[model samples]
Target chain A: MEQHLVDCDLCFDALQVLQQQQYREKYQPLSASMQQYIRNSIKQVSHAHKAERYQRQEQKKESFLIYFWVVAAIAAGAGLIYLIQQQDKFKPSVTKAMASNAEIPAQRVEAPAVQAAVVTPVRAERADTLSHRPAPPAATTTAPVAPPAATPAPATPKPVIKDSVKAKTPAAVPVNKDSAKKQAPPATKPAEVKETVKAPAPEHKDTPTVAKKTEDKPEPKPVPKEKKDDDDDKPKPKPATETAASGTDEFLYKAAMVYHQQGDLNEAISRYKHLSGSSGKYGELSRYQLAVCYRSKGQTGKARRMFKEVVRMNGSMKDKAQAALDNL
Target chain B: MLQQLSNLSDKELISRARKLKDQEAEGVLMERYSHLMVAVCLPYLNNGPATSPEEIYPALLQRLSDSLKTQTIPKANEWIHYTIRAQQARTDKNSPFFPSTESREQQQIEARIEKAATNQKEQQQLIATIERTLDKLSAEEKYLLKEFYMNNKSFAALAETKQISIEKLRQTLQQAKQKMASLLMNETYE
Candidate 1:
């Protein structure tokens, strides 16, 4: 630049003028204001960029909040579904427990009917054979056979069972059946008579076969046996008729049948079970009806056992009990 | 703050303007060269509406300020001088200032000299390379370089000794300096 300045007269002249320090003063204030102008522009640009960045951050925050709410709602809905499903699991079990409670009491009542069906038929036969005894033969001529047979509690059902089993020859089974049919009261409802009319087959078969058995026995045993035979034949024909015609057990049984007809099976079962302990035409009938109550209550096992006991008694009800057992 | 800014080098001021976007640093840089701009522009002032002092000086400073962000300005004087001349011609308002190849080469050598200043071995090597390149120039360039740089003679005194117009002499000297800078730049690349 020092070498070039010698040849450039115009630049040399401009330099000489600037050496005076007068033109330097002229440009200074204009320079100051231009610098101020550029600084103002920088401030404006920086402020604008800062505002844009802040707006972007706020937009990001709002988007994140929206996502959070959507996830929260989905979680809450899932929780509600799970809660409902959990409750559904317990609901059916509660219903099943209530059903089981109802069935347990039903089973308890059926159990007693089953017991009475097993115990009472033999006792009723015992009571009928013993209660019809004439007072004198019951003491003397019939003492050998009647002493054991007439004992109230211990020996009575055994003798009655032995007599009933030994008495029903195949020949007499039909005869007793006919007697049971003839003896059903005309005043009774057909349903009660259906069981009662069938009641006397084993009773009649036992007496007639017993009389024949006494007649056929050895001479020494036959003498005492014929006395019992006379006592059983003479009074049993009349007293048995009297007992069958108007027995307390018969009326009680009619009441139980009414309850059975009314669809109050529990009451009917309790009544039948009560009469089931006595002996007469009605005792056998109550045992048969108790089995019907057990069947109605859906206690088929107990019903089957009760029917088997009635069949074991070999009564007129044996055919009906066998048919019921086959149905079960 | 302005006093502190005034004490910083031109490189620091340019960095503050471009990197830090410090408008005040830019203002200080423009102000530093304002007097030379006023002097250089004085001849063309009031020659036309486009050349008025009220219009040209501010427009010239603004043009330099705009170019400062994008341009590689190693030497502020050469860049500013080229721009002032470009603005004075008034042919293209939107045309940006660019440093010439010769100016860039000269700026590279200046940078190399500054880098080697603290290293005695590099400074000596640089001085030897400059001397060897000066020995390669034509007699007149060598003579003018010696007379102007060595003797510290003014441009007018050198033009008088050579018995030529100062304009032609200035052009020859400019070409000689350009040749030296290119040779130095090529030597560095090798």
Candidate 2:
């Protein structure tokens, strides 16, 4: 029939007209009532779907909040546990200090005897040196008097004694004595009193052991001043060695960092200053922290100066120091 | 809700209908394609006799409701093909061109050729012959011819329903037309 329509012009024209008429009839829009019915049905379906979607979203939100609260509670519980553990670790040292304080008086009585035993050999050597001199007993008698006088005198003599003793004695003994004097002032004072009996030995015999004993006597007399000088001299090259040996500098540095993190600027500043004065591993870091402390405390001039010094050193703190300087 | 439904596309409305069984989404889908449904019904209704709009409209609606219930309708263009096929099948069953008494073995021979007559008589016979030839086609083939030649639906829509490319749909359409031509010439399509 298609071939027949293509061969015959009249049949082709009739088919085209029929098809066009069919197209026109088919394209006619539906009646208004049918359209209204469809619109109403669509409105119902859309409402149902929307309600279902909204319910699902609400359920999801509720589940998310529940999980968030659960996670937050777990994190808070872990933090509390950690804090408790830290407190337990630190409490024993405080209890030990309190226990030691309670036993101090008993220790004081026995302390003098221990000092006598420790000082006897040095004193006997001094006595032997006095046997060689004519006026050595006079020197021994004057030694106790000299100490009382020196106790009232200025800090200048402490350095002279330290330098002479350090020059004459074995290097290790003076360092040990200096550290001992630094560590326990009360115990060292009685020990120094016993050693004062041996102070005349160095003058008589010129022996290094007696010299060291003589140095130990005057050490407690000008304790505060001698400590300052010893701190200044000991930290220069031996700060790393000393901190490595004892771990006190590292502990103090950690404490300082904790204070800084805790926003205790004043305490952090004090700790950083002490650590900065020492040439330990933390020295450069402490200097940087000290600058940060000063800057936080609103002492911009001191902060800037410290930052400049750190920048000049060009150590680990150089970049931070440069940034701090720029911020200032 | 109606405003929201109005904002959604035809594909979205159908998806909602399928997934959520949303009555409003089905209603929206019906509204979107009702014109095409009415158009496809007109060809079947107007082909033989002058059927009343009242009679045709209810029957069309009934067929659409049945198809929607079955959920067998494809996309808009392909869906129109299904509706046309359904209309043609109903029309043929109600008014068959060939009598059921004619055995398949007897009908296998070519249809009798009529003598050439007056121009009006010849045109009427051509129309009858075309209708007879269309009835010989399977429902699927009738739907393809109606959508392709009559409605001129986009090849893209046909391809999507067929799950093939537009070029493939065009090639298939060409082959279908050749087979249709052979059937019209009283030759076996196979």
Query: What does candidate 1 score on TM?
Result: 0.40
lDDT of 2 at A234: 30
- What DockQ, on C-alphas, does every prediction get? 0.14, 0.12
lDDT string, candidate 2, A1-328, tens digits: 4433322232333334345764564344444556765665456445667789889999999999999999999999999999999887555433432333343344445545544654444433333232224334544554555776666443533343344344433543454354344442332332454334333322222222232332323343244234533222232223224334235556567777777888989878877775664443476788889899999889999899889877766788899899989989
Residue-level lDDT for B3 in candidate 1: 71
Q: What is the model-wide C-alpha lDDT for candidate 1? A: 0.65
**Candidate 1, A1-328: lDDT as tens digits:** 6544543333455576566675666556644654465456445545456458668988999999999999999999999999888767444434433433454355445535643663244334433333333223433444565666665744654454455445532323344334443543432232243334335433444444543342222443334235533322323333335555344355567667767888989978887776564445466678889999999999998788878877876778989999999999
TM values, all candidates: 0.40, 0.28
**Candidate 1 segments whose C-alpha is farther than 4 A from its true place:** A1-328, B165-168
Name the docking class for model 2: incorrect
lDDT of 2 by residue, B167-190 (tens): 466556655555555565554333
- Model 1 chain A weakest 10-residue run by lDDT: A228-237
After superposing candidate 2, which stretches have Cα over 4 Å from the reference? Answer: A1-30, A45-66, A69-328, B1-9, B19-23, B35-74, B80-190
How well does candidate 2 reproduce the true complex, by DockQ? Answer: 0.12
